[model samples]
Target: MTILRRLAAAAIVIGLGMTALGLAATADWRLGLIVNFRLQLLFGFMILVAIMIAVGDRRWLVPAVAGLAINAILVGPWFGFGLGTSSGESVTVLHLNLLAANRDTAAVVELLHETDADIAFLAEATASWRRRLRLVEIPFDVVATPGDVRFGIIALSRIPVETRVLGVSTFQLPTPLLSFDLDGEPITVMSFHTTSPVNTRRDAARDEQLMALSDLVSSVDGHGVLIGDLNATPWTPGMSLIEDAGYQNSLRSSGLQPSWPAGLGPFMIPIDHAFHSEGLEVIDRRTVASSGSDHLGVEIELAVKR
Candidate 1:
């Protein structure tokens, strides 16, 4: 056979290998850290599969197609290519993890104005940043949970805000649970920022936070919304808690809108997310242009199961 055919065959093997590793990650979090990286590599593996398919080798065609099919199954729905289905009335929500060290508060203000979301959440906010946000006025009432030397949580909403700090966070970050009264309807809103799972301690903290968030989701009696930077991808074992909690990802129908490390373009992982209970559904979802921060902002339109 030709050297090109050999290369195509080799590439197919690599793609399948990587896809397998990503699937393995779903089982648990012990390999969560490593498998998360492999999951990211799925993009490149799919590219290689495409290249081989384009090369037109009969032997490589089947493997290449299979690789593509796997991605199409696992990653396809994230791009919102799923069968178009309607849920409830649309209420827009914008969520972002504003870098605490970022000095460009003006960008946040502009993004808020640009998205014009019914509710907005800014995580990793500093006291000064909170003060700056006070300047720009939107239709929603504002709830700034600014405590000293912790992950500052802030929320802006048109609905009535009922702050509920469930229990103390193991990571000492702000409680993610917030309740809102919108047009006589009660919606539980949680602004969560799971601790970055960069290290063992932090990963443990992140796991704990997810557990707490899951419990909070299960405990809610009415419609609920969870918005924040979860740090873990949806496929990770850490996210299983959310799945077990009976919540759905807002972007599931819309597609995977990668939100972090903005300059990477399509290469960024989607750390920021909006998850809601069965009582709520995301009717429309979109990601905004990078708001001068590492993570891109996400705006989702939710429909309550009325």
Candidate 2:
């Protein structure tokens, strides 16, 4: 019983601390990293409350419940929000971050063939990947930027597309901004990857890149779709900045579609995402099977709003 009490107290303290950190996420990059695990914290609090109830520990109940509520509020929007209900022309997109070290080019190629998406956006398209893809005859038109193990972005399209490569983020990685027509309407797409904010410098660079991308998205005249491994969660300032640009997160309808650290299964958090502008709405959204990459791809169908 003594041990049980100690455990309960620790849980309460840790849970409360996490809640506080998430609330103060914008204060520091490290805090923002903790905020990314809001979903995990929510689950932890839930289990904590359940244990408290079963053990008849009313003393720890109040604070534990409070922590649970705070986390619920923070992560609730990903379950569902203003989901697009537009019945207009739609296009399917597959966005993946192929791990630079993974050499299973055949599996990746097979997955791409299986999905046969209207447009496929790939990150970490290193020279090795380009060489492997070239040997095969793919059905889609491929547009790729010169990429090494550290940087690269590619787009494969079944429809006609005009693409421009933009240097983004602090490292100045190649990002593709693609333009194509969908059912007579001009639509734009940006396949981007931000620096993983593991440190202060990378965090600032990620934010700067996010702001620049948001401005670019806002400048589009008709409709736009943004997809990739953003290295930021929906609750983070990075995603909020993009949302502020008039784009809606597809996860709002798809729920918390966690797509990173592919081996973790239910323990993973969503860093990869798909967002559509005001003129376009999400018709469907889901995560694809693993292609030997640490990150699983996101499949989204977006429609032009009538």
Candidate 3:
């Protein structure tokens, strides 16, 4: 019995230590592996507690309960908050990656109109897809560069776009960086579908594109909004680099919501995001319903503070 008590105490101490380490090492880029390992320790601790409970070890159960309580207090709320709120005079924008396989253009278009976003950015748009989008009239001004496999991006805006440009050879992916003026407010927006990191070649290409995009955003003179299917999560190291470059994540400011692999279970990761500069106030944010696409649409409203 004494030996069991000692083992239980050791487990509790180790679990708490790992949790603390994870929280502390989160800010250091070099300690990413350490942080990840600490997270694993937390999970392992839970598994150990379950085993102890199954074995009917009452002495070990006390420490197990305490460890769980600590984890709940620290890590549980990280997944629960909604995105930020905004003051008046804000424009809402929607970002969606209509997958190449998705054919429900009508439903997507209707949702775009229903959302009443000031601007809507859609990726994986082909020439035919653009024609279908023309049926929706809310976005009077539209810009698109259609590709062979419907892998291009299109921006539809209610406000007149004064300037627009496609990022030339930014990366292996043929995505574009678009800039526009909203009633004298200069907003630079980029819509991209980086190569997924499922393969080495694709992952390298995606990382390069992200680096280039980060450079472009940093060099811009005015407010910027980067909306797209980044194919990377906010918690990842690459995304952290972007965060370091003076832009804030829209979802992280309010909540950490996952938006991916639609039709699957809820244990999803947030790969699609809209990041903005400090000049904008994020009012409201939400994820739209699945439109036969693997990814769900994310909408963010921002007030351009003068």
Candidate 4:
């Protein structure tokens, strides 16, 4: 009886610790610690379950089943499943992280032709890559400013672009904000690749960029859409600021779909996202095939409410 009591106590303590670690992973700003905490929680739960099995405790099964069910509901859609319907005026937008080191430019172009998205956003692009992409006979006008090291972004549109604005001042952070007028209606779109918080300098710059971006989006005079590799998740506080600025997540309204660390096992994190203002509707969303990049591609079709 004493042995059983000691085992139960250990199990309870471990379970509580796992729960706390999971919560901390969600709340903490430090990226490394956050990842570590999540891993700890995941393994900690497994350990607790193993202990329960060893102790032959049937009562623990109830909570274990409930926890697994909740996790499934939260994470099942990340496996490239669609959650909603497309609007009648739907225009497909594809966001891809073309690894800078990739050499198969022809393959990339072929994939673009195959998908035939109405608009395409590419990150980590280089001048050579942009030149290579220009050779593809896609019916689109392309705008790109290739970067040497970091945060290179590009946008291409099949429809005629009436106006294109690049780079509005954002709290001295050099992130580009691109906007275009599509189909006689102005759609303000911004593609951002914020500094990853893994390092101190990058983290501070990213935070500043986010603050400025929130202010810019809030001040926009018309409908707007923001998309890119945010390097953060919907549940994060930084994302909360963007949500508070009146933008709705295309995924959250449908489901939380993780889209990062492509091919690094099934447990993914949602770093790439699409957030839009009230005048737009998300018709459909899915992840595209990987292109040798660490991040997977996200494709979203959105409609302007006429």
Candidate 5:
């Protein structure tokens, strides 16, 4: 009992600290803790649950439950009825962060063939990926040339597509902005890949890149879809910046579908995302199977609002 109490107390304290990092410093890696806001929230609650199971100690119970309640209220908008409803025209998009290190290109190719998405956006698409995809029967593909960087982005569309490499990214690693017509409407899609905020330098770069992308997204006059491995949750400051650009998170109504660290079972984080403008409505969203990749595919179905 005493040992359990000690463990419970330590868990609570640690949980509290993690929660604090999420709330106060999600963008910064502080005290050797990376502020993965959603994960921190989740694990904090899990710790609280462990404590309850061990001792049902009211001292920690009330505050922990209260914290959970507060988080629920805060994240409510992050999980349902995103943007608005529309019946005009529907389009399905699939975004996959094909792990650059994974060699099972055949499995990835198979998954792509199975999905039959209208447009498929891929990140970390190296030359190897380019060659593999070319060998496949998929049509109308655009793969970025490996610049000074190692790998880049790729897009495969069944319809006509125009891909432009973004020139604003700090590194030559730019998210290609794609333009294509859907149901007679000119729609734009940008595939972004930001640096994972693991440390101070990386975090700063991500913040800068996010701000640039958000500003660009805000001015996009027509309907647009932004997809990619953002490397941060929707609740992060970087994501909030994008939200402020008037693009609604497509996965908001899709529930917390974990996309990264695929081997972690239920403890993974959702860093991949799709955001769209007011002219679009996210009708449905789901995560795809991990194709020997650390990240799973994020499939989003959207409709143009009439």
Candidate 6:
């Protein structure tokens, strides 16, 4: 084989191993981090396969095709092509991780106003951030939990809302549940910020928080939406618990709206998410530009299922 073909074969072998390792994320938290990049892996394999095909390098075709298949299965569901739509009163919701230390209040506020979402959930919203937001003209009623500076949660709404702070989970983060009426229909919105799983302990804590959120969703009597920086991706292990709770990931139809590590562009992952109950369906969803945080905000329009 030529030097170029040899290099292609070596890369394909490594890429196939990485794809297999990502599938083991359910067995190890560190591997879970790798799994979040399944989209990148899939694209990398595709590019490699195309190059090999162009050069007529057939020797490594089998392993290259296998690598592509593995990554494709892990990343395909998010690009939900045949997901049906819904019709009824719709609400525009926005969820952004404010990156606690971000001081670009004007820019973030401007983004909020520009979106003009009916309901907004801001994660990592510190007391100072809330104070700064208050100084400016906030057109919506606001509720916030200022206990934890790193994960303080905020909910802003134009509709009348009944807000309550639920008990902290294993991660010691308080979850805010917002109850409101949408066109005379009662709807619940829960906003939470799970600890980022950078280590084994943190990963376990995040998993516990995810389970708690799932149980809470299951207990809701009617329609509900989950909005926050979950710190876990749709493909992560614990996410299955959320889906089992009967809430469909809004990103399913919207595809992979990578919202974290905002400046990285293609290197980013969709850790921030919005999931709605069976009674609701997504009408529109997209990621907002990085205003002042490491995470890009998500704006989704959901309507009552018809």
Q: Residue 255 of model 1: what lDDT?
A: 70
What is candidate 4's lDDT per residue for 170-263, written digit by digit as tens?
5342334445554456677666676677766666666676666678789776778778888776544566678789887787656656677788
- Better structure of 3 and 4 per lDDT: 3
User: How good is model 2 by TM-score?
Assistant: 0.94
What digit string (tens of lDDT, one per residue) describes model 6 on residues 1-306? 478788888889888877888889978888989888888888988988887897897878778888888888878877775344665678888888898899999888888778858888888888788788879986677775556555588888887778877875755567788887765678898888888899998889899989998988998878899888899888898998989999988888778889889989779888988999988878888899678999999998887766
Per-residue lDDT of model 3, residues 1-306, tens digit only: 556656766777777766665556434433333343432454666776876777687776777777677665554544555444444466778888888778898778677768768778888786667777777655346754544544678777776565455453354455545566644677776666776765556556666777777776788778888788888765445676666778878875557556777766444667788888888767777889767678889988877765
Better of 3 and 6 by TM-score: 6
* Candidate 3: regions farther than 4 A off: 1-86, 134-139, 146-150, 168-184
- For residue 296, what is the lDDT in candidate 2? 86
Name the lDDT value of residue 231 in candidate 2.
Answer: 93
TM-score of each: 0.83, 0.94, 0.73, 0.75, 0.88, 0.94
How many pairs of residues collide in each model? 8, 0, 2, 2, 0, 0
Residue pairs with colliding backbones in model 3 are: 85-283, 86-283
**Ranking of all candidate structures by their TM-score, best first:** 6, 2, 5, 1, 4, 3
Reference-based TM-score, model 4: 0.75
The sequence of per-residue lDDT tens digits that candidate 2 reaches over residues 91-147 is: 999998988888988888888889948999888887877778889877788875655
Q: How accurate is candidate 5 locally (lDDT)?
A: 0.75
Lowest lDDT sum, 10 consecutive residues, model 6, at 80-89
RMSD for each of the candidates: 3.4, 1.9, 6.1, 5.0, 2.7, 1.8
177-252, model 5: which lDDT tens digit per residue?
7787766788888888888777899888887888887887986768899898988876677778888889978767
Candidate 1: residue 205 lDDT (0-100): 81
Clashing pairs in 1: 78-255, 78-256, 79-255, 80-254, 80-255, 140-157, 140-158, 141-157
What's the CA error at residue 280 for candidate 3, in Å? 1.6
